[model samples]
Target: MTQVTIYTQNNCPPCTFVKNYLTAHHIAFEERNIANPTYRNEMIAHDAFATPFILLNDEPMYQVDMDKLNQTLGL
Candidate 1:
């Protein structure tokens, strides 16, 4: 199984969109709220400057490029 992690915050439409897209595609993912103190250092360590930052197998993916993402997942 592919491991996916998404860094997001509340009230972010793009974040929600990405989550929904993943769900619709039956992709399993873990969501981390960037606003949470527990994930703050992790986010910083990953150098995620934007909301909705995604990680695939511990590799930082900074944007929601659906085409590339789908291709990466072999979807």
Candidate 2:
């Protein structure tokens, strides 16, 4: 099984969009909220400077390129 993780900040519309898209597709993902200090540090450790930083199978994806994401997931 491929592990998917998304690092997000609070009240972010794009973050909500991504989560909704994933949920709608029945794609499971682990979300790290950057609003929390611990998760923020975690995101920073990954050198992520933006909200909704997605990790697909441990590979970092910094933007909401849905087509690429879909291809990566083989959807």
Candidate 3:
């Protein structure tokens, strides 16, 4: 089950890092790209205005923040 959501945009290195980190850890996640107008608003609504904004169990954060995210996900 996916407990992670990452909001990203094209050519953002941090976004790629977040995705690659998740993949490396075998963590499942839903990707929401801000390139989509709808998703841009969603990310802002969640108080994440940057690429690689991450949500773990509905808690908002930016970038990987593995320790915090893993804590939330009970990883």
Candidate 4:
């Protein structure tokens, strides 16, 4: 099973988009809000300084690259 993790920040439209996309597709994802220091640190650890940082099976996807996301998920 692929483990999906999404790093997001508050007041981010892209973050909402990603989350909605995943939900609409029935894909299970763990959302890590960057508002939390621990999650922010985790995002920084992945070298991502923006919202909608997605990790699919531990692979990182920065920003809202739907093409890359679809390809990765075999959609």
Task: Give a tens-digit lDDT track for model 4, residues 1-75.
Answer: 678999988899998998898899888899999889999999999999988898989888886788888887677
Output candidate 1 Cα RMSD: 0.9
lDDT of 2 by residue, 1-72 (tens): 668999998899999999999999899999999878998888888888998999899988878898989998
TM-score of 3: 0.84
Choose 1 or 2, whichever is better by TM-score: 1
Q: Looking at candidate 2, what is the lDDT of residue 7?
A: 94
- Off-target runs (Cα >4 Å) in candidate 4 are none
Instruction: For model 2, give the RMSD to the true fold.
Output: 1.0
Per-residue alpha-carbon lDDT of candidate 3 for residues 11-56, written as tens digits (9 for 90 to 100): 9998898788778878899999888999999998987777888877
Q: Give lDDT per model, in order.
A: 0.88, 0.89, 0.82, 0.88
Q: lDDT tens digits, residues 17-43, model 1? A: 999989999999999997898786788
**Model 1, residue 1: what's the lDDT?**
72
Range of the 10 consecutive residues with the lowest summed lDDT in candidate 1: 40-49
TM-score of each: 0.92, 0.91, 0.84, 0.91
**Model 1 misses residue 58 by how many Å?**
0.9
Clashing residue pairs in candidate 4 are none
Which number leads on TM-score? 1
**Candidate topping lDDT:** 2
For candidate 2, list the clashing residue pairs, or say none.
none
